[model samples]
Target chain A: MATIGIILFTLVVTLAVMLGKCQKKPLSNACASFAFNTEMNNLQGYLLPQECEGYVAGYVNSGQYHSDFAVAIEAARTYLNTIEADQDGKDLIVLDIDETALSNMPYYVDHHYGVETFNGETWNAWVNNASAPALDAMLSLYTDFRAQNWSFAFITGRSKSQYNKTAQNLYDTGYTGWKTLVLRLPDEENLTADEYKSKHRKRLEEEGYRIKSCLGDQWSDCSGESAGKRTFKLPNPMYYIY
Target chain B: MATIGIILFTLVVTLAVMLGKCQKKPLSNACASFAFNTEMNNLQGYLLPQECEGYVAGYVNSGQYHSDFAVAIEAARTYLNTIEADQDGKDLIVLDIDETALSNMPYYVDHHYGVETFNGETWNAWVNNASAPALDAMLSLYTDFRAQNWSFAFITGRSKSQYNKTAQNLYDTGYTGWKTLVLRLPDEENLTADEYKSKHRKRLEEEGYRIKSCLGDQWSDCSGESAGKRTFKLPNPMYYIY
Candidate 1:
């Protein structure tokens, strides 16, 4: 009877182990766990397009994307009205370059959402093309902010060499009047986008500008000390940057 | 009769859910899910010292730490011999400070493995003390490398301000004769450790040094472009740096 009971326990344990494996998550035991379906979900709070290409593509290709941005615009308009800008303190909005202001959907679509790994050469080529379309929601928000007399600072992790192309791209996409355009210097290439952006915001503050709203798709955009009074995080589960 | 059957089924499901929660291993659904647990595990490989106080203390207090170091030394020696280094290409090893060469375990112990978050003032005080013990394994490996005529370059995320204290600590802890000590400049404070280290490694390459092996306790230590011929990652789950 004892032996039979032991045999039953073994069978149950084996079944449990098999069930665990079938849950469709990445195995953290291996070194290649980064960009795995599970790691992307845990760290980025969304699924990669590679994992569900159809769903993400469908969401972005449809009117649903427009609806989501509309809601964000509503919130931004309310916040902009709440704060009163005076001559003593110049009101400013800090914006991220990628995904937040511009859509890299074409690049992501070609690469399978980083499933094939991010190739720098190809990405640089895409940046040079400067054909990325404006995210309508962010573009709308930018117009509203401009109407309210708020100045803008565009901070990006793009290399300093790409400054001209990026500026042209923004202009072509209808970003008319940003007061400052901060690009990552070659020496500052080691800084994470978050760290790089935070420093730029601090520099603006030192120069006597008050950041009323900071907007980005990644948590790193709105995180760290000296963050603005309001932060709006748009949805981008497609990719994450440290 | 139908209501009673439905109640019984609900009770059984609840019991199963409770049992799943009580399991010893991490739940894929829970906060300590496999990927999060894996990230923590990868960072603090096999060391629960921060999360579980007594377990880490018990592991380090025992001869287990030394044994683990011995295993690492063995791996390093085998890899060192396997690679061919010549006079044409000066063989170099990149070393990271803090937990890679000298341990901050004492500080972690005092603070309960940073359960209270990293306090810079207290950590600076500890750095000022400069009494951190050398990892017997890494120290032994260093001696072996020196014997083989391979030069050493110490590149760390430590600020330039901490150079004197860090150098003193290394000397007191038995590290002697390194080619260069690269400290993070004040302007480079915003750079992620990985980016800073990668740039330093790249600079060394440009200056005609061939990095044979790079060792650190974090993935950022081994990742990015211009990484060494080989990378060795030591276990460090106490804290994470972006």
Candidate 2:
């Protein structure tokens, strides 16, 4: 009788899962975990912006964000030390502008970390103001690379039209002496950031520079053909561009 | 002066997109396009479940879900027509039991679509009830394959212990005449659904079965080595399982 009851109970429970009530109201925990795992594996081609607000907020507030980047940079530093310096053409470090060199925390904070819609007009004024500060961790890494006499190049999604202001902003923010600042030409504006940036890196390689390291916040920064020998990614749960 | 201001404004607007605010909101339009592209490409990786809920909900609520499967099955039918009938060995079509063969719509509707925690006991009881209705679209496909003399196999994530009840449910629900129903054994329960399912597909291949098509709601149902020549997917936005 006991065994029969147990069997019956089990059957009933299974039936409930298959035929029970509407399990609406969202699985918050499961949703969060699933999104995190998917992003970690880069399984999805890209993330939905609406799915990022809370996730990004938590990431920025967490100390883990800084530590993750620090760990990646440390690993990169160790790897770079092993590579023998080039005597002829300089070994290069490809740096993505925007979130890579300058922190956009101010804009993100004001806008609720990407919860708001992106307005081109508002963003352009902010950039032209040149108030954005350098990312301390990346700044330190940049200084270290400079100490080793590596050439720095900025490959950004920014258009060539913003050349003067962007240049002035970079110089004012303490990232001096970059070998090249490759901006997207008007003809290449429609291409993806990955396509545009990869094209520039290939051009640089053709000009006899070996990219020793590539650093950025987006996967597109490190992906594509002619990507660097080493790549370091910073946390940017605030938004996904790719 | 107005013309100059307009030109300046255009430049700034372009620069803003290049250098401005965090573009964080989920682009529903973009998400739809990307998911469509990913599915068309049959990309190896999976989608983030959180990111797919709205899209999936829209798909199911709309008639698009049924139509999509109809198109896929139609394509398979055309392809299957080319295969010569074999007398000694039989061609096989693999189906995932839970969402593919049986519709768990009742449970999802009542439970709010997997928002709540998955209670194994409750789900087991539901399964024991053996009342899940057949998915009409898939049943028609199954019948069509049978008409061609093709064999059918079921590979599910359900534990081996649930074999008897699961079999009963499938039979009662009109998914009869399957060649084999493979369940996850105790030792294999720890593996991800993808890894375990891949193992079974490989084993089936080793046993000399030629898999012509595989159908399921999850990418795991159709990915990895020994995957079928053709794969068909159905929509499920409630939750994702690895």
Candidate 3:
């Protein structure tokens, strides 16, 4: 009976020590990193089927993504209203094409919402088809600015080969009165999105256009030199350009 | 009876029309904006009691905030590992004090997780106490790098008046062997956080320190000229500096 008591006491003490150690080390770095990345990706609407069941039903199908887009557009409108446009009729609004003015959500949806690795062939096919629709909130913002004498310039990462198709889609999607739809030339194809966009913005400035505001779903779009007077980042968790 | 039937049919038609309008306009701009702001604020650990019940039981208390910090620090570690540190001993790692190095979580918890407007009196008192704890992940990173030859520089927005207290707190929190601790001078108080931080970063560069990586909780701390070779943005949604 005394030996049994001793054994029980040792077990209890060992359990207490283990519990104390666990309390001291609440979470391992690896565990925390994994949890954080998963949660962030899920919240941002870029979860994979393996990461979460019903991936489409999580972000795109759910109205949260649309709500976030609306919020961003509203904020942009507020900022734009505060900007005093120059009287020279040279006020330009720089916009990114994919996930900004035009949403390739349909293509992304088919491609596992960016969980699948990007395929140039599939992406080019989608762009060539050119049935992409204008993001509703962005389209609204575009329509409102069109009436206000702001020149709209779409600076996209799309190759110059798809210029006609992209232009047709833009016009079909009610993006009329755009000043210019700039596509990446073959030489510029190797440049990072920031570099490519910045070059065009500098050129636009040299051409006597004052970039009032720049809007895009990626940080690369709103970064780099000549990033406009104000830059608005729309949420895009699908893919990172640079 | 026939007149009553006609009235009922008209009522049904009116109800259907109203339902259709509701479906068409699922959420108003104001409603979406408010909801989006509240949701983002909650997720980022900046929430008011009026926005949600048991506000403190959210983000910070839920361990999500710490997990995010860990994830960011992990990413920084991964990035830092890829950089080939020059042999000159001029390779400096720039750090922001508040949130990045020393967490002001205890003080922020009392201040409703930043729902309360920043109070100079209470904030200074808390700073003068010299009791802020080191953010565990950042402190671990700092300790690991300290064993190596990487020089550390803390460029903070805190006024020079609280320099001694800040230093004392830093020392007490196991942060030693730092190269320099920079505090905002009296004249720099008027400058925005970005401007002030930028000036110091440029000065660091001129002083022959190669800023390899800059880690900060706010965008302002990692932006502007001479923002180091790479900037790692720590998760801080409590308050925006700019």
Which regions in candidate 1 have their CA more than 4 angstroms from the true location? Answer: A1-242, B1-51, B62-66
Summed backbone clashes in each candidate are 3, 30, 0
RMSD of each: 12.8, 18.9, 13.0
Model 3 DockQ reads 0.09
lDDT score for candidate 1 against the true structure: 0.69
Tell me the tens digit of each residue's lDDT in model 1 across B100-150: 888898888888754566678998899889899998888888877777778
C-alpha lDDT of residue A164 in model 2? 83
* Residue-wise C-alpha lDDT for candidate 3, range B140-164, written one tens digit per residue: 9888877767888999999999999
lDDT, candidate 2, residue A2? Answer: 53
Ranking by DockQ: 3, 1, 2
- For candidate 3 chain A, the 10 contiguous residues with the lowest summed lDDT are A38-47
After superposing candidate 3 on the true structure, give the runs of residues whose Cα lies further than 4 Å from its correct spot: A1-57, B1-57
Q: iRMS of each prediction in angstroms?
A: 13.9, 27.1, 22.7
Using TM-score as the yardstick, the better of models 1 and 3 is 3
TM-score for each candidate, following the candidate numbering:
0.43, 0.47, 0.80
**Candidate 2 lDDT over residue span A150-228, tens digit each:** 7889998877888888888888888888899998899998988878889989989999999877877776787767776
Question: Could you tell me the TM-score of candidate 3?
Answer: 0.80
> Considering lDDT, which of the candidate structures 2 and 3 is the better prediction for this target?
3
Q: In angstroms, how far off is A115's CA in candidate 3?
A: 1.1
Residues A1-242, candidate 3: write the lDDT tens digits: 55545555555555555545544533333333343344222122233433432433344565756777777787778878777666566899999999999989889878777778679999999999999989999999999977887778999999999999999999999999998999999999899888999999999999999898898877678677777766776766466676
